[model samples]
Target: MGGVTFTAGGSGEITGATFSSGQTNATVSSATVSFTGAIFHNAVMDSLVVSGNSSLTARNCTFTSNGRRGLYVETIYPQGLVTDCHFRDNQEYPIWIKANCMDMLGAGLQFSGNHYQSIAVSCSAGTDIQRSQSWRGQPVALDLTVGSTSGLTVPAGVTLTVAGPVTALCRRFEVAGTLRVGTGNGYQAWLTGPADTRGSWEGIHVSSGGVLCLTDARLTYATTGVSANGATVTLTGSRIVNSLYDGLSTTSDCTVHLDRSYLRLNGRYGLNLLGRVTGRVQNTELAYNGSHPVYALAANVSCLGSGNLYPSNGRIPVGVSCALEPDLTESATWTAQSVAYDLTVNPYGTVLSIGAGCVLTLSPGTLVRGGGVDVHGCLEALGTAAQPVRFLPLGRQEPGSWEGLYFYPGSTALLRHCQVYYAKVGMAITSAGGYVANSQFRSCSGPGISCAGTANPTFYRCVISDNQGVGVYTRDSAAPNLGNLDSAPTHDDGYNILQNNGQYDFRNESSVSPRAQNNYWGTTDPAVVEARIWDGRDQAGLGRVWYLPLATSPAAAFAAPVTGLIMAGATALQAPGGNVEIRVHLLSPASVSLRVCNVAGRVVCSVPDRLTGGVGERLILWNARSDTGRRLPAGAYLLELTARSPDGPSTRRLVPLVLR
Candidate 1:
C-alpha cells in the first residue's frame, strides 16, 4: 500500500510504516485516514496529500521530502490535522492548503528544511487563518481572521486588522497588539458580521485547552467580544468595547481574570459568568453596558478586588451576590464574613451591628461608610501597611458627616493599620475592650477615641490628629490604657501620637485625673499642654488630664531613653558669679534643662533652659543665676538636670551646689 490511492469513501488507521520512492505516496478522495508513528519519504513525490472532501489526521508522523511539496490539502471542503510531524528537505512548500479546505496545524509541526514557504494557503475569502503556534506580528498591518486554531499571539506595536469575522473554534486567542475595527477606522481590528441578532460569524470562541489572554490590547465592535467555553480568559491593561453582544461571556466551568482592564458600551452585560464560572475582577472598569456591568448566574461565582468602577447606570446583577455585607436598612446583626466591596450603612437609624463572637473581616482597601458600626461582636479589620481599611462617610466628607464605630459593652474590635475619618467620633467605646494598633483617626468632629463606662481599649502605635474636637476623650469610669509603662524590657514599645486637634488632645471629664502619659504633644512646652487640655485647670468641676512625664518627640512616645549626668571636676558647684560646668552623657538627642531649688523641692530658678545636645557627652556651662536674675548668698542649692529625648522619657539628676 506504499503507492495506494483511495478513490472511494473509507476510514482506516495506519501506524509505524514508511512509504517512499513513489510518484504520489498516497491520495485520498472521499476517504478518512488517521495515522500515528508513520513515515513518508518522498524520492520524487509530487503530492503526499489529501483531496476531494477527504479528512486526514496524523500525529507523530515524519514526511521527508526530496525537492517536492511535502503535504497538500487541495480538494473542496477537505480537513487535515497534523501534530508533532516533521517535514524536512522539501524544496517547495512543506504544507499547502486550498482556500476552501481546512487544516488544523497543531503544535510540534516542524518544516526547517523547506526551501520555499513552510505553509502556503490560497487567499480566496481573504479571511484570517487559524494558527497553532505562537505568532510574532510585525509593525505592518496584518489582515487576518483566526479559524479553528489552537491560539494566536500578537506582540506589542503590531496592528492586526481583522479582515472578516474572526472565529476560534475551541482555541485560545491573545493579542498584545492593537486590534480594532478595521473598516471604519482602519487602525482597529474588528469582527465582521451581521449587526442583527442573527449574526452567523462566531466571534472569538475559546474552549477547552484554550486560554484567551490580552494585554494592552484594544478589541472593539465584535458580535461578541469574547466567548469563553470551559476555558480560561485573562485581560490585563486591555479594553473590550462596542460589542453587539456581551463584552465577555464565561460559561461551562470557565475562569476569567481581569486586571486593570476596561469594558465599555457593550450591547449586553460587560461580563457574564454563567454555568459555574468563576471570575476575579480587579482594578478593572466596566461601564455603559446595555445590561449590568457584571451578570452572574449565582453569588458564589466572582470575587471583587480593589479599585473597580461600577457605573451608576449599571445595576447589580439580580442573582449574583455582591462582595459587600448584606444590604440592610435597619439595625441587623452581622455574622462572621468577608467583605470584598465597599459597604455603606444606610441612614434612618440603621446600624450595622456585628453579633458576638462573629468576626467581620474587611478586605484591604474596602471602605465601610455611613452610619456607625455597632460592634456587638468582634471586628477584625487587619490590613497591611500598603492597603488599609478605610472607614469614611458615605455622603459629606466633612467632620461629623456620620457617626463612627460604637463598641458595645461585651463586644470588641481589632483594628490594625486602619483609618477612620470624616466622622462624628472615630470610635466610641463603652464597657468594651479591644486593641487598636497602627491605626489613624483624622478629621473627626468629636474625639478620635472616646472611652466611657470602663472601656479600656489598648492603643499602640496609633495616630489621632486633626480632629475638630478632642483627640482622645475619657469620660466617667473610662480607663483607656495607653503605651506600656513596664520598667523591664518589652516589645510593647509603641505609643499613640496626638497632635493638631482643634480642641484638647485629651479631655478628662471624670472626677479623677486620668493619666494620659507618654504621648507626644505637638509642642514640648508645658504651658502649651496646660492650655490645650480641658482638665481641672480649665474647669473646676471636671477632672484633670495628668500629662506629666510627657513625651518630648514622636520617637520618645514609644520607648524611654537613658541618660547620665555628672559634675565636671568637683562635687561642690558655685553659683552666682562662679561658673559651674556639668557634663551630660546621652544615648540619644535630647533637650537639656537645669533647675535650681532651695532643698525644699521648689524650683527657685530655671538655671539653663532649652539646652540642646546630640548623642555622646556634652558639657553645659551655667552662670548660676536665679530666676530673679540676682546673686544668691552662700547656701546649699539643689541643682537638677533633666534631659529629654525622642525615644523615651527624660532622665533627671539632682546635685547640691554651694554658693560662696
Candidate 2:
C-alpha cells in the first residue's frame, strides 16, 4: 500500500494492520491518531512520523527493519502515549523525540538491534526531571535539572549523554536514591556530550546534599566535567577527560574521594579546589591538563596520596598555599612531585606526613613568606636511605634565608633519614618531644638544634654540622638525649656527629644536665673537646655536658650505599586477599631477610631468611598477613629487606606499602 497521510482535522484509528515497503509508512499531522496491534517494516523513509501538535497513541506495535527511525515524534505541545511497543533493526535510532515529550513513554517498551541503540532527544530549554528513573541499554540525550527529591540512575553497561548548552543539575536528592553513574564490571559507562567539539554542554553540577558515586565511568567533552558545591562525590576506576574547563572543580564544603582514576586533557586544572574541601586522591593520574594538575588553595583539602602520577602537565609542582585553619581534624600525606613543593602547616592536631623522596623548599616571600613548616601538630617525615627527603632553600643557598622547621609546645615529630639545609635554625624544639634518626641538620645560621622549655628530643645517628652558632643549644631546663653514655642495650645507641661550628659544639644554658657521650664531636682530644664545650665548667650556673667516653672516630654515615642488591615491587594491595610479589636481584651470593613493619616501626611479619647461591633474581610473595597467619588490617606499612654478602658488602631497602 502507498504511504497514508492524516491531514489536519482528521482522526484515524488503525488496529491489527501490517504496512510494508512504503515510502513513508504513516504520517500523522492530524488532530488525533491511534495505532494498536500494528506492524510497520521495511519503510523507504521513517516508519512513523508524528508532528504539528498531533496526539499519537501507539500500543502493542512492532516496528522492525525500517529504513529510518522506527518512530519519530516532534511536537511542541506533546500529548501522546506509547506503551508495550517493540522497535528493532532500524536504520537510525529506535525512537526519536523531543525532550518535552519524554513523559509520554510508558511501561513495557522494548528496543533492540538498531543502528543507534538510543532514544535521541533534543531540547533547547532544559527539562526538570522529578521522578526516580533508571536509564539502561540506551543513551538519552538531554539537559536535565533533577529535582531536589528525585534520583537518576544510569545502570551498569549503559550510557547517558548530557547534551545541549545548559548545565545539568544533579542536586539534593533527599527522598530517593542518590545519583549513581556506573556499577563496576569492567564496563565503563559513558556520560558524554557531543564528540565533535569540546564544551558542547555545560557539565554536571552536583550541589547541596547531592551524592554522586561513579565507578567504571567515563565523562568527557563539557565545560567542566563535574562541579561540586557542598556535595559528596566518589569516583573509582573512572576517567574524566577532554573538558574545556577543569575535570573536577570543588568549591565550598565538599568531600571527594577519587581512586584509581584518570583526569586528563582538560583545558584547566584536573582538580581545582577552593574552600574547605576534604578528601583523598589515591593511585590516580592527573596528567596532560592545560593548567595545574591539582590547584588547591584550600587548607583543609588533602590533595595527596601514594602511587599517583603527574606527568606532562602545564605546571610541575603541586601548589599549596593554605593554612590549616584552627586545627587539622584529619591526617594528610605529602608525596613527591615532579618539582620541589612549597608547604606551610600551622596549628593542627592531625599529623602531616611527608613521604619518602619528597623535596620541600621555602620560596622567599611567597606562601608563608620567609617561613618554613611551623608545626604545632604532629609531623612524620619518613624517608628511606635510598630516597631521603630534603628541605632546602629555594633561591638563596645561604643560612638565614628561610626560617627552618619549628616544633612548638604540645607538638610531636618523627624525622627519619631527612636532610635540612640553609635555614636560620635547622630545627627548634620548644617544649616538644620527638625522635630524630639518621638525619642531617646542616648550614644553619643559628644553632643546628635549639632545645628549650623542658623539651626532650632524642637524636640517634644524626649529623649536626657547619652552623654559625652551636651544634646543639639547650635552655630553660631542657634535656636532650644525645647518646647513651653507658654501653647499655636498654637505650638507643645515639651515634650523633657534631662538627664545624663557629661557636661551641654543645652549649648548656639550662640548669639540667644532658648526656653527650658516645658521640663524635669533631675531635678525639679531650682538651679540644672540653674547649669546644660550654657547660658547667665554663658557666657557673649552667649544667654540664658529659663528654666522656667519646667516639674515637666518625660513626657510619647517615645513608648507606646501595651496592649489591636491588628490589622492586608494587606499592599497594588494593583489596582483601590481595598479595604483592616483590622482585629481588642480587649482585652476588647473599643472605636475604625480609620483614614487614607497620607505620610505627614494629615488625609484624618476617619471612624466613634465605641464602642465594648465586647472583640471580628472586621473587617473594607477601600474603598481607601477620607472622601468626592473621590477616593484616588495611593501612600503611613498610617492607624492609636486608641483603648481606659473604665478602662484607651489604645493602638495605625500605619500600612503602599500602594494604587496602
Candidate 3:
C-alpha cells in the first residue's frame, strides 16, 4: 500500500483485484504506487484511486472490464505519470483527473469501449496550462488560465463547455470550436457559461499582449462577455449577448476589430472603449443594451469604420471623442454612420474632413471642459444644399450650452452650406483666413462671427441672425471681406444677411476699416444703419465701417411689386451651356441688380447693377455659369432681380428656374 511496486512477469496478468461493493479496488493514500506490466481486469469498483499526497506511475498497464473508472484521481494536488496504459470496457470514464492535475497526464494512454471516453476535469483552484493544447470532446469544469507563450485552441466541431471562467494571460485562446450550455440554436460555435442569470461566471479575459480571435462564435451569460486589456482582439461574425456588463470592453492601447457581429441584451454598453484604443468596427449590430450601444468618450479612441447599426438601446447616440494624433499625416473623413463625434485637431498637417449631412455635437467633458471643435489644423466641412452639415449642442437647445468652433492662428477651414446652432460663439477666427459661404450662424450666445488678429475670412451669402451679441465682431486690425462696393461680380461677392442681432449688426473694434457694402442690414436708412453699427461713429478709436451702398432688400426676397418694373422670363434652362433671358419691363427708370442663386440660397452668379434709361422692356441674359466661369450643375436655381427706383423704394422678384 505504501511505496510498493506491483509487477507481473512478462506477458502475464494480475487478476481478481477485487474490493467490497461501492469501494475502490485499490487506494494509494500518502504513498507512491508503481505498476509495471500489470493487467487489472474484472474489478467490481474503480481499478485505482490516488488519494492525498500520493503519486502513481503506471507503465505498460492494461485496465479493462472494470465496473467503474479505470483510474480516478481524488487528491487536492495529485501527481501521476500514466504511460502506455490500455483501458477498455469500463463502466465509467477510462481516466478521471482534476483540472489542476491535468499536467500529470502523459502520452501513450489508450482508451476504448468505456461509458465515458472523455476525461472529466474539475478544478477548485485555477490552473495554469503551460503547453500548447487542443481540447475537444471533453467536458471542462472550472476556470482555466493559459500561461504566456502558450496557445489553447478548441478544435472545430467540438462543443467545449466552460462552467467557469477562461482567461489567457499574454497568450492566445482561439475558439474555432463551440461552447454552449442551453439549447438555443443560431451560431455555428457558441462559447457559453452556466449562467441561468447574468454574471453567473466571469467571462473570457485576454490580458496584455494576448490575442483572442473568435470567428463565427457566440458568447452569452457572463459578467463581461469579453475583455481585451491592451490586447489584440478580433471578433468576426460573432454574437455576444446577455452579459451582466458591457458585451465587449477594450482598455487602453488595445486594438480590436469587430466585423459583422451582434451584441445585444447586455447590461451596459455593447462595446466600451477606454483610453487611446484604436481599431475599426464595421457591419456590426449593437442593440437592446442597457446603456449606450458604444461608449467611446475617452480621448483618441476612434473606431473608424462604417456600416454599423445601433438601435433600441438605452441611448441612441453613439458617443465618441477623439484627439487626432500630431503624427497623423493622412486626411480623415468622419461619416454620419456614427451619430455624433466630439473631436480636436492637433497642429498637424492633417485635414479632418466631415462628410455631407454629418452632425457634430459639442458636449462638455469630451475633449475639453468647454466642448467645441478646437482646430489648430485644417478642417474641410463641405455640405450640399440638400444635405447640409450641422453643428449642435449635446443636451439643451440653449445658447452657450457649449463652446463653438475656434479656429486658432494658422488654422484654416472651409465651411459651406453648414448650420451652426446654439453655441457660445458660432465661429471664432483668430489670425486665420478661410472661406465661409452659404452657411448660417444662428441663435448664438455671443457674436455670430468673431474675427480678431488680422483674420481675413470671406463671408459670402451667409446669414448671421438672432445672436445675443453683435452679428459680426472684428477687432485688432481684422479686415473680413463682407462685400466690396466697386468690385466686379465674383463668387466672393458678399450678400450676407446680418439682422436681428441683440447688439450692433456690425461692430468694428479694429483700427483698420473693412468694406461691408453689398450686405443687407435690416433696413436701408442710413440713420438706422448708423444706429445699428458700432464703429468710428460710436467710438473714435475703432475704424469706421463703410456702408455707403446697401442692398435694397434681402438677396432672396420674393416678388414684391414696385410701381415701375414688371418681370417675365424663361422658367427653365435646357442645358448648362444654354442661356436664359429675362425681360424686365420698367414702367419708370430704375437701377436693376440680377443674381442667380442655387437651391440653398447662395448667389452663384451676379449681374452688375445697371440703370434703365427709358420705360421699355430690357432683356438680361444669363449663361448658367458661376461667377468664376465654372459650368453649374443641372439643378434648381432662383433668379433674384431687385430694382431700385430713383427714390429710395425697391422691389424684388424671385424666378425659379430648372436646368436639365
Local distance difference test scores for all models? 0.61, 0.68, 0.64
lDDT of 3 by residue, 1-660 (tens): 112222322122233233323345566766766667766666677777776777677787877877887877766555557777788888977776554355566666777888865555443333323233333222222222222323334334433343212221112243334323222223544555543578765677766666666666677777888877777778777888998999988776788898988999999989888755667888999999997788764332347466888879886666554434332222344455545543321222112222211222221111222256655544455555655677777677888776888776645556666788888999998876666767889999999999999787777778999999889999999988887656543444667888999878899998988888778888988889888989988888889898768888887511211122222111222323477655454545677788888988899999867446455445566777799998789888877777767775555655556766
Worst ten in a row by lDDT for model 3? 557-566
Please list all clashing residue pairs in model 3, or write none if there are none: 179-190
Error of 2 at 481 (Å): 2.2
| Sort by lDDT, top down from the best | 2, 3, 1
TM-score of 2: 0.63
Where model 3 places Cα greater than 4 Å from the true spot, the runs are 1-128, 137-186, 297-301, 321-333, 342-370, 484-491, 522-530, 546-660
Error in Å for residue 148 of model 1: 21
For model 2, residues 1-660, the per-residue Cα lDDT tens digits are 448888888888989988788888888885698999999889987888888878999999999999988888776567778888998999987887665466677667887888876676544332323333434323333223222323233322222332121122221122112566676744446666644366865666776666677787777887888888887788899888898999988878888899999999999889887767877888899999986788775354345556678898886555555454432433355556544554432232212222221112211211222347666555566677766777777566898777788877645556667888878898999976666778899989999999999788778788999999899999999998887646343233657899998678888999988887888887889999988889889879999987787888887856642232222111222333588655454546777777899989999999866446455445566778899999899898888777777776565655556777
lDDT of 2 at 94: 80
Task: Output the lDDT of residue 311, model 3.
Answer: 79
lDDT of 3 at 266: 97
Consecutive 10-residue window with the lowest summed lDDT within model 1: 562-571
- How many residue pairs clash in each candidate at the backbone level? 8, 0, 1
Winner on lDDT (1 vs 2): 2
TM-score of each: 0.43, 0.63, 0.60
* Poorly placed runs, candidate 1 (over 4 Å): 1-193, 196-219, 222-239, 243-255, 259-396, 402-419, 430-432, 437-439, 452-454, 474-478, 484-515, 520-546, 552-660
Question: Best candidate, lDDT-wise?
Answer: 2
